[model samples]
Target: MYPNDGFRELERAECLRLLAKVPVGRIVHTRQALPAVVPLNFRLDDDGSVVVRISARSELVRAIDGSVVAFEADEIDAGAQSGWSVVVTGAAAVVTDPAACERLARTGPQSWAPSPQEVFVRIRPELVTGRQLVGGRTLYGVDLPS
Candidate 1:
Protein backbone atom coordinates (compact mmCIF):
# COMPACT_ATOMS: atom_id res chain seq x y z
CA MET A 1 0.00 0.00 0.00
CA TYR A 2 1.12 3.59 -0.62
CA PRO A 3 2.45 5.31 2.45
CA ASN A 4 0.00 7.41 4.37
CA ASP A 5 2.68 9.62 5.89
CA GLY A 6 3.86 11.41 2.72
CA PHE A 7 6.19 11.20 -0.22
CA ARG A 8 9.93 11.45 0.25
CA GLU A 9 11.37 14.91 -0.26
CA LEU A 10 14.08 14.39 -2.81
CA GLU A 11 17.31 16.32 -2.61
CA ARG A 12 18.57 18.52 -5.43
CA ALA A 13 20.81 15.83 -6.85
CA GLU A 14 18.05 13.27 -6.58
CA CYS A 15 15.57 15.62 -8.19
CA LEU A 16 17.94 16.28 -11.07
CA ARG A 17 18.44 12.57 -11.48
CA LEU A 18 14.70 12.08 -11.81
CA LEU A 19 14.42 14.99 -14.24
CA ALA A 20 17.17 13.54 -16.36
CA LYS A 21 15.29 10.29 -16.79
CA VAL A 22 12.00 11.98 -17.63
CA PRO A 23 11.90 13.49 -21.12
CA VAL A 24 8.58 15.26 -21.07
CA GLY A 25 7.00 17.64 -18.55
CA ARG A 26 3.89 19.76 -18.33
CA ILE A 27 4.75 23.43 -18.68
CA VAL A 28 2.09 25.58 -16.98
CA HIS A 29 1.75 29.27 -17.58
CA THR A 30 -0.94 31.85 -16.93
CA ARG A 31 -2.97 32.55 -20.05
CA GLN A 32 -5.30 35.42 -19.23
CA ALA A 33 -8.25 33.43 -17.83
CA LEU A 34 -6.36 30.75 -16.00
CA PRO A 35 -3.39 28.40 -16.33
CA ALA A 36 -2.28 26.74 -19.50
CA VAL A 37 -0.47 23.45 -19.36
CA VAL A 38 1.47 22.19 -22.31
CA PRO A 39 3.57 19.08 -22.66
CA LEU A 40 7.13 19.87 -23.63
CA ASN A 41 10.21 17.85 -24.27
CA PHE A 42 12.98 19.20 -22.08
CA ARG A 43 16.42 18.54 -20.64
CA LEU A 44 17.61 19.36 -17.17
CA ASP A 45 20.80 21.36 -16.97
CA ASP A 46 23.45 21.12 -14.29
CA ASP A 47 22.24 24.49 -12.99
CA GLY A 48 18.87 22.80 -12.19
CA SER A 49 16.79 24.37 -14.92
CA VAL A 50 14.85 22.91 -17.80
CA VAL A 51 15.89 23.81 -21.37
CA VAL A 52 13.38 23.45 -24.13
CA ARG A 53 13.48 24.42 -27.79
CA ILE A 54 10.52 25.93 -29.54
CA SER A 55 9.73 28.04 -32.55
CA ALA A 56 9.98 31.77 -32.07
CA ARG A 57 6.35 32.22 -33.11
CA SER A 58 4.86 29.43 -31.06
CA GLU A 59 2.05 30.24 -28.65
CA LEU A 60 3.89 28.76 -25.68
CA VAL A 61 6.99 30.72 -26.52
CA ARG A 62 5.05 33.96 -26.64
CA ALA A 63 3.09 33.31 -23.46
CA ILE A 64 6.00 32.23 -21.30
CA ASP A 65 8.55 34.96 -21.84
CA GLY A 66 9.15 37.15 -18.78
CA SER A 67 6.43 35.30 -16.90
CA VAL A 68 6.54 32.78 -14.10
CA VAL A 69 5.70 29.24 -15.11
CA ALA A 70 5.55 25.78 -13.67
CA PHE A 71 7.10 22.67 -15.14
CA GLU A 72 6.40 19.17 -13.89
CA ALA A 73 7.65 15.74 -14.85
CA ASP A 74 6.90 12.29 -13.53
CA GLU A 75 7.62 8.63 -14.00
CA ILE A 76 5.67 5.53 -13.02
CA ASP A 77 6.23 1.79 -13.02
CA ALA A 78 2.96 -0.04 -12.82
CA GLY A 79 4.39 -3.53 -12.54
CA ALA A 80 7.05 -2.56 -10.02
CA GLN A 81 4.84 -0.24 -8.04
CA SER A 82 7.27 2.67 -8.07
CA GLY A 83 7.01 6.23 -9.33
CA TRP A 84 8.29 9.79 -8.86
CA SER A 85 7.33 13.36 -9.74
CA VAL A 86 8.99 16.77 -9.76
CA VAL A 87 7.71 20.32 -10.06
CA VAL A 88 9.80 23.36 -10.94
CA THR A 89 8.43 26.87 -10.63
CA GLY A 90 10.41 29.64 -12.20
CA ALA A 91 10.66 32.56 -14.55
CA ALA A 92 10.84 31.79 -18.22
CA ALA A 93 12.39 33.80 -20.99
CA VAL A 94 13.33 33.55 -24.59
CA VAL A 95 16.91 32.75 -25.30
CA THR A 96 16.94 35.31 -28.09
CA ASP A 97 20.35 36.55 -27.12
CA PRO A 98 22.53 34.66 -29.56
CA ALA A 99 25.10 33.63 -27.00
CA ALA A 100 22.50 32.49 -24.52
CA CYS A 101 20.62 30.48 -27.10
CA GLU A 102 23.80 28.82 -28.29
CA ARG A 103 24.81 27.95 -24.78
CA LEU A 104 21.36 26.54 -24.03
CA ALA A 105 21.22 24.69 -27.33
CA ARG A 106 24.39 22.84 -26.48
CA THR A 107 22.48 21.05 -23.75
CA GLY A 108 20.41 19.38 -26.50
CA PRO A 109 16.83 18.97 -25.34
CA GLN A 110 14.59 17.26 -27.85
CA SER A 111 12.72 19.96 -29.74
CA TRP A 112 9.05 20.62 -28.96
CA ALA A 113 7.71 18.48 -31.76
CA PRO A 114 7.81 19.13 -35.55
CA SER A 115 11.00 20.31 -37.19
CA PRO A 116 13.22 23.37 -37.20
CA GLN A 117 12.55 24.60 -33.73
CA GLU A 118 13.75 28.20 -34.00
CA VAL A 119 13.42 29.53 -30.50
CA PHE A 120 14.61 28.36 -27.13
CA VAL A 121 12.71 28.83 -23.88
CA ARG A 122 14.71 28.45 -20.71
CA ILE A 123 13.00 27.93 -17.37
CA ARG A 124 15.28 28.91 -14.54
CA PRO A 125 13.66 27.42 -11.51
CA GLU A 126 13.14 29.74 -8.58
CA LEU A 127 11.49 27.03 -6.50
CA VAL A 128 12.09 23.38 -7.19
CA THR A 129 10.47 20.51 -5.31
CA GLY A 130 9.77 16.86 -5.82
CA ARG A 131 8.61 13.62 -4.20
CA GLN A 132 9.25 9.93 -4.55
CA LEU A 133 7.25 6.99 -3.33
CA VAL A 134 9.78 4.93 -1.42
CA GLY A 135 9.47 2.68 1.59
CA GLY A 136 6.00 4.11 2.28
CA ARG A 137 7.33 7.56 3.11
CA THR A 138 5.39 10.41 1.48
CA LEU A 139 7.72 13.36 1.72
CA TYR A 140 6.81 16.49 -0.18
CA GLY A 141 10.19 17.89 -1.25
CA VAL A 142 9.03 21.48 -1.45
CA ASP A 143 10.32 24.05 1.00
CA LEU A 144 7.13 23.35 2.93
CA PRO A 145 5.80 19.86 3.19
CA SER A 146 2.31 19.28 1.83
Candidate 2:
Protein backbone atom coordinates (compact mmCIF):
# COMPACT_ATOMS: atom_id res chain seq x y z
CA MET A 1 0.00 0.00 0.00
CA TYR A 2 1.11 3.57 -0.62
CA PRO A 3 1.57 6.17 2.04
CA ASN A 4 -1.45 7.72 3.74
CA ASP A 5 -0.17 11.28 3.80
CA GLY A 6 -2.82 12.44 1.35
CA PHE A 7 -0.56 11.81 -1.61
CA ARG A 8 1.04 9.03 -3.58
CA GLU A 9 4.38 9.14 -5.36
CA LEU A 10 4.07 8.23 -9.00
CA GLU A 11 6.64 6.19 -10.85
CA ARG A 12 8.32 7.43 -14.03
CA ALA A 13 6.15 5.23 -16.25
CA GLU A 14 2.98 6.40 -14.56
CA CYS A 15 4.05 10.02 -14.82
CA LEU A 16 4.67 9.70 -18.55
CA ARG A 17 1.32 8.00 -19.02
CA LEU A 18 -0.46 10.82 -17.23
CA LEU A 19 1.46 13.41 -19.25
CA ALA A 20 0.29 11.79 -22.49
CA LYS A 21 -3.36 12.18 -21.52
CA VAL A 22 -3.13 15.94 -20.95
CA PRO A 23 -3.35 18.29 -23.93
CA VAL A 24 -2.15 21.50 -22.32
CA GLY A 25 0.73 22.06 -19.93
CA ARG A 26 2.72 24.95 -18.50
CA ILE A 27 6.35 25.56 -19.30
CA VAL A 28 8.22 27.27 -16.48
CA HIS A 29 11.33 29.16 -17.41
CA THR A 30 13.30 32.23 -16.46
CA ARG A 31 12.51 35.58 -18.02
CA GLN A 32 14.44 38.71 -17.04
CA ALA A 33 15.71 36.67 -14.10
CA LEU A 34 12.15 35.96 -12.98
CA PRO A 35 10.08 32.87 -13.44
CA ALA A 36 7.77 32.91 -16.44
CA VAL A 37 5.02 30.39 -16.99
CA VAL A 38 3.23 29.86 -20.26
CA PRO A 39 0.31 27.59 -21.02
CA LEU A 40 1.01 25.70 -24.22
CA ASN A 41 -0.43 22.98 -26.37
CA PHE A 42 1.96 20.05 -26.34
CA ARG A 43 2.40 16.41 -27.14
CA LEU A 44 4.65 13.73 -25.73
CA ASP A 45 6.82 12.36 -28.50
CA ASP A 46 7.52 8.65 -28.94
CA ASP A 47 10.83 9.16 -27.17
CA GLY A 48 8.99 10.85 -24.23
CA SER A 49 10.20 14.35 -25.04
CA VAL A 50 7.81 17.22 -24.37
CA VAL A 51 7.28 18.97 -27.68
CA VAL A 52 5.62 22.37 -28.00
CA ARG A 53 5.05 24.35 -31.15
CA ILE A 54 5.42 28.08 -30.71
CA SER A 55 5.61 31.12 -32.87
CA ALA A 56 8.96 31.73 -34.47
CA ARG A 57 9.07 35.28 -33.13
CA SER A 58 8.25 34.30 -29.62
CA GLU A 59 10.96 35.45 -27.22
CA LEU A 60 10.42 32.27 -25.29
CA VAL A 61 12.58 30.50 -27.80
CA ARG A 62 15.57 32.57 -26.79
CA ALA A 63 14.70 32.61 -23.12
CA ILE A 64 14.35 28.86 -22.69
CA ASP A 65 16.33 27.19 -25.42
CA GLY A 66 19.55 25.54 -24.24
CA SER A 67 18.43 25.98 -20.65
CA VAL A 68 16.91 23.91 -17.91
CA VAL A 69 13.17 24.34 -17.70
CA ALA A 70 10.28 22.82 -15.87
CA PHE A 71 7.19 21.47 -17.60
CA GLU A 72 4.10 20.63 -15.61
CA ALA A 73 0.66 19.21 -16.36
CA ASP A 74 -2.10 18.28 -14.01
CA GLU A 75 -5.68 17.11 -13.64
CA ILE A 76 -7.72 18.23 -10.66
CA ASP A 77 -11.19 17.19 -9.55
CA ALA A 78 -12.68 20.02 -7.55
CA GLY A 79 -15.69 18.04 -6.52
CA ALA A 80 -13.73 14.97 -5.52
CA GLN A 81 -10.92 17.12 -4.10
CA SER A 82 -8.36 14.95 -5.79
CA GLY A 83 -5.79 15.48 -8.48
CA TRP A 84 -2.44 14.50 -9.93
CA SER A 85 0.42 16.82 -10.80
CA VAL A 86 3.48 15.90 -12.80
CA VAL A 87 6.67 17.87 -13.31
CA VAL A 88 9.45 17.33 -15.83
CA THR A 89 12.74 19.13 -15.46
CA GLY A 90 15.05 19.06 -18.41
CA ALA A 91 17.01 20.90 -21.04
CA ALA A 92 14.98 22.79 -23.64
CA ALA A 93 16.26 23.01 -27.15
CA VAL A 94 14.93 24.42 -30.40
CA VAL A 95 14.87 21.83 -33.16
CA THR A 96 17.21 22.91 -35.97
CA ASP A 97 17.74 19.76 -38.00
CA PRO A 98 16.13 20.16 -41.43
CA ALA A 99 14.86 16.62 -41.61
CA ALA A 100 13.54 16.62 -38.05
CA CYS A 101 11.94 20.00 -38.56
CA GLU A 102 10.15 18.77 -41.64
CA ARG A 103 8.83 15.74 -39.81
CA LEU A 104 7.73 17.82 -36.89
CA ALA A 105 6.00 20.28 -39.19
CA ARG A 106 4.00 17.45 -40.71
CA THR A 107 3.05 16.06 -37.30
CA GLY A 108 2.60 19.25 -35.36
CA PRO A 109 1.21 20.19 -32.03
CA GLN A 110 -0.21 23.18 -33.96
CA SER A 111 0.40 26.61 -32.52
CA TRP A 112 -2.51 27.94 -30.53
CA ALA A 113 -1.78 31.36 -31.91
CA PRO A 114 -2.08 32.23 -35.57
CA SER A 115 1.50 32.35 -36.77
CA PRO A 116 2.85 32.28 -40.29
CA GLN A 117 5.89 30.37 -39.08
CA GLU A 118 6.36 28.21 -36.02
CA VAL A 119 9.07 26.14 -34.45
CA PHE A 120 9.27 23.24 -32.08
CA VAL A 121 10.93 23.17 -28.67
CA ARG A 122 11.86 19.76 -27.38
CA ILE A 123 12.45 19.25 -23.66
CA ARG A 124 14.43 16.12 -22.99
CA PRO A 125 13.24 15.16 -19.53
CA GLU A 126 16.10 14.54 -17.15
CA LEU A 127 13.98 14.21 -14.07
CA VAL A 128 10.36 13.12 -13.82
CA THR A 129 8.34 13.14 -10.63
CA GLY A 130 4.68 13.39 -9.69
CA ARG A 131 2.20 13.06 -6.86
CA GLN A 132 -1.48 12.23 -6.63
CA LEU A 133 -3.67 13.68 -3.93
CA VAL A 134 -5.74 10.77 -2.73
CA GLY A 135 -6.49 11.50 0.91
CA GLY A 136 -8.88 14.42 1.06
CA ARG A 137 -11.22 12.38 3.17
CA THR A 138 -8.57 10.66 5.21
CA LEU A 139 -6.96 13.91 6.33
CA TYR A 140 -10.28 15.35 7.50
CA GLY A 141 -11.46 12.16 9.13
CA VAL A 142 -8.35 11.67 11.20
CA ASP A 143 -8.30 13.11 14.68
CA LEU A 144 -5.61 15.68 15.38
CA PRO A 145 -3.31 15.71 18.37
CA SER A 146 -4.35 19.14 19.48
Candidate 3:
Protein backbone atom coordinates (compact mmCIF):
# COMPACT_ATOMS: atom_id res chain seq x y z
CA MET A 1 0.00 0.00 0.00
CA TYR A 2 1.08 3.56 -0.57
CA PRO A 3 2.16 5.75 2.28
CA ASN A 4 -0.34 8.12 3.81
CA ASP A 5 -0.49 11.38 1.93
CA GLY A 6 -0.26 14.74 3.60
CA PHE A 7 -3.00 16.18 1.42
CA ARG A 8 -6.62 16.01 2.43
CA GLU A 9 -9.59 16.09 0.16
CA LEU A 10 -12.03 18.94 0.53
CA GLU A 11 -15.77 18.34 0.51
CA ARG A 12 -17.84 19.78 -2.28
CA ALA A 13 -19.32 22.49 -0.11
CA GLU A 14 -15.93 23.34 1.28
CA CYS A 15 -14.46 23.43 -2.20
CA LEU A 16 -17.05 25.90 -3.33
CA ARG A 17 -16.44 27.99 -0.28
CA LEU A 18 -12.72 28.07 -0.99
CA LEU A 19 -13.35 28.93 -4.62
CA ALA A 20 -15.36 31.91 -3.50
CA LYS A 21 -12.34 33.28 -1.72
CA VAL A 22 -10.30 33.57 -4.93
CA PRO A 23 -11.09 35.98 -7.77
CA VAL A 24 -8.82 34.55 -10.46
CA GLY A 25 -8.26 31.14 -12.03
CA ARG A 26 -6.71 29.40 -15.00
CA ILE A 27 -8.97 27.88 -17.61
CA VAL A 28 -7.67 24.96 -19.66
CA HIS A 29 -9.13 24.29 -23.06
CA THR A 30 -8.23 23.24 -26.58
CA ARG A 31 -6.78 25.81 -28.89
CA GLN A 32 -5.99 24.88 -32.50
CA ALA A 33 -6.03 21.23 -31.50
CA LEU A 34 -3.49 21.84 -28.74
CA PRO A 35 -3.94 22.42 -25.02
CA ALA A 36 -4.14 25.99 -23.90
CA VAL A 37 -4.37 27.58 -20.48
CA VAL A 38 -5.40 31.15 -19.86
CA PRO A 39 -5.82 33.16 -16.73
CA LEU A 40 -9.18 34.80 -16.10
CA ASN A 41 -10.98 36.68 -13.42
CA PHE A 42 -14.07 34.80 -12.41
CA ARG A 43 -16.87 34.54 -9.91
CA LEU A 44 -18.71 31.58 -8.48
CA ASP A 45 -22.43 31.31 -8.99
CA ASP A 46 -24.91 29.96 -6.48
CA ASP A 47 -25.36 26.86 -8.61
CA GLY A 48 -21.64 26.05 -8.43
CA SER A 49 -20.76 27.39 -11.82
CA VAL A 50 -17.85 29.67 -12.75
CA VAL A 51 -18.50 32.83 -14.72
CA VAL A 52 -15.93 34.90 -16.56
CA ARG A 53 -15.96 37.81 -18.91
CA ILE A 54 -14.37 37.47 -22.34
CA SER A 55 -14.04 39.81 -25.21
CA ALA A 56 -16.07 39.04 -28.31
CA ARG A 57 -12.94 38.86 -30.38
CA SER A 58 -10.98 36.69 -28.00
CA GLU A 59 -9.88 33.31 -29.31
CA LEU A 60 -11.09 31.65 -26.16
CA VAL A 61 -14.64 32.68 -27.02
CA ARG A 62 -14.74 30.13 -29.80
CA ALA A 63 -12.48 27.53 -28.23
CA ILE A 64 -14.44 27.05 -25.01
CA ASP A 65 -18.05 27.37 -26.00
CA GLY A 66 -19.90 24.05 -25.90
CA SER A 67 -16.71 22.35 -24.80
CA VAL A 68 -15.57 20.66 -21.64
CA VAL A 69 -12.90 22.61 -19.81
CA ALA A 70 -11.00 22.67 -16.56
CA PHE A 71 -10.57 25.64 -14.27
CA GLU A 72 -8.06 25.80 -11.44
CA ALA A 73 -7.56 28.24 -8.59
CA ASP A 74 -5.12 28.04 -5.76
CA GLU A 75 -3.67 29.85 -2.77
CA ILE A 76 -0.09 29.15 -1.75
CA ASP A 77 2.06 30.12 1.22
CA ALA A 78 5.62 29.91 -0.05
CA GLY A 79 7.14 30.50 3.34
CA ALA A 80 5.02 27.76 4.89
CA GLN A 81 5.15 25.41 1.87
CA SER A 82 1.48 24.70 2.35
CA GLY A 83 -1.44 25.58 0.17
CA TRP A 84 -4.80 24.57 -1.28
CA SER A 85 -5.79 24.02 -4.88
CA VAL A 86 -9.17 23.54 -6.45
CA VAL A 87 -10.00 22.23 -9.89
CA VAL A 88 -13.39 22.34 -11.56
CA THR A 89 -14.30 20.59 -14.78
CA GLY A 90 -17.46 21.09 -16.74
CA ALA A 91 -19.17 22.20 -19.90
CA ALA A 92 -18.65 25.79 -20.87
CA ALA A 93 -21.43 27.69 -22.57
CA VAL A 94 -21.56 31.18 -23.88
CA VAL A 95 -24.27 33.30 -22.40
CA THR A 96 -26.24 34.61 -25.33
CA ASP A 97 -29.51 35.31 -23.64
CA PRO A 98 -29.79 39.04 -23.19
CA ALA A 99 -31.47 38.84 -19.82
CA ALA A 100 -29.04 36.32 -18.42
CA CYS A 101 -26.11 38.18 -19.84
CA GLU A 102 -27.27 41.36 -18.24
CA ARG A 103 -27.68 39.70 -14.89
CA LEU A 104 -24.25 38.09 -15.01
CA ALA A 105 -22.65 41.30 -16.18
CA ARG A 106 -24.02 43.04 -13.14
CA THR A 107 -22.70 40.45 -10.68
CA GLY A 108 -19.72 38.85 -12.42
CA PRO A 109 -16.08 39.74 -11.82
CA GLN A 110 -14.74 42.74 -13.63
CA SER A 111 -12.20 42.04 -16.32
CA TRP A 112 -8.66 43.14 -15.51
CA ALA A 113 -7.60 43.06 -19.14
CA PRO A 114 -8.26 45.93 -21.46
CA SER A 115 -11.20 44.87 -23.50
CA PRO A 116 -14.89 45.45 -23.93
CA GLN A 117 -15.60 42.05 -22.33
CA GLU A 118 -19.10 41.94 -23.76
CA VAL A 119 -19.27 38.19 -23.64
CA PHE A 120 -19.83 36.02 -20.60
CA VAL A 121 -19.04 32.35 -20.42
CA ARG A 122 -20.41 30.06 -17.74
CA ILE A 123 -18.80 26.78 -16.80
CA ARG A 124 -21.34 24.49 -15.17
CA PRO A 125 -19.20 22.26 -12.99
CA GLU A 126 -19.75 18.55 -13.28
CA LEU A 127 -16.78 17.72 -11.09
CA VAL A 128 -15.30 19.82 -8.33
CA THR A 129 -12.33 18.64 -6.32
CA GLY A 130 -9.88 20.25 -3.96
CA ARG A 131 -6.89 19.30 -1.86
CA GLN A 132 -5.18 21.06 1.01
CA LEU A 133 -1.77 20.38 2.42
CA VAL A 134 -1.74 19.58 6.12
CA GLY A 135 1.00 21.41 7.95
CA GLY A 136 2.96 20.77 11.11
CA ARG A 137 4.78 23.13 13.41
CA THR A 138 8.12 24.43 12.18
CA LEU A 139 11.22 25.64 14.05
CA TYR A 140 10.22 29.23 13.31
CA GLY A 141 7.00 28.67 15.24
CA VAL A 142 5.16 28.68 11.93
CA ASP A 143 2.62 25.94 11.44
CA LEU A 144 4.04 24.43 8.26
CA PRO A 145 4.99 20.88 7.44
CA SER A 146 8.68 20.16 7.16
Considering only N, C-alpha and C atoms within 3 Å, which residue pairs clash in candidate 1?
A: 6-138, 6-139, 7-138, 7-139, 8-139
Per-residue lDDT for 15-133 in model 2, tens only? Answer: 99999999999999999999899989898887888999987788999899999999999998867878788888899999999998898888858776768878899999888878776
- Order the numbered candidates by TM-score, best leading: 2, 3, 1
**Which candidate leads in TM-score?**
2
Q: How good is model 3 by TM-score?
A: 0.84
Candidate ranking (lDDT, best to worst): 2, 3, 1
Better of 1 and 3 by TM-score: 3
Which residues of candidate 1, in runs, are more than 4 Å off? Answer: 1-5, 78-81, 112-117, 135-146
Q: Write the per-residue lDDT of candidate 1 for residues 61-84, one digit (tens) a residue.
A: 778999989899988665565688
Compare the candidates by lDDT and give the number of the best one.
2
Candidate 3 Cα lDDT to native:
0.83
Better of 2 and 3 by lDDT: 2
Q: What C-alpha lDDT, on a 0 to 100 scale, does residue 67 get in candidate 3? A: 98
lDDT string, candidate 3, 73-122, tens digits? 98878678677878899999988899988888788777777585568899
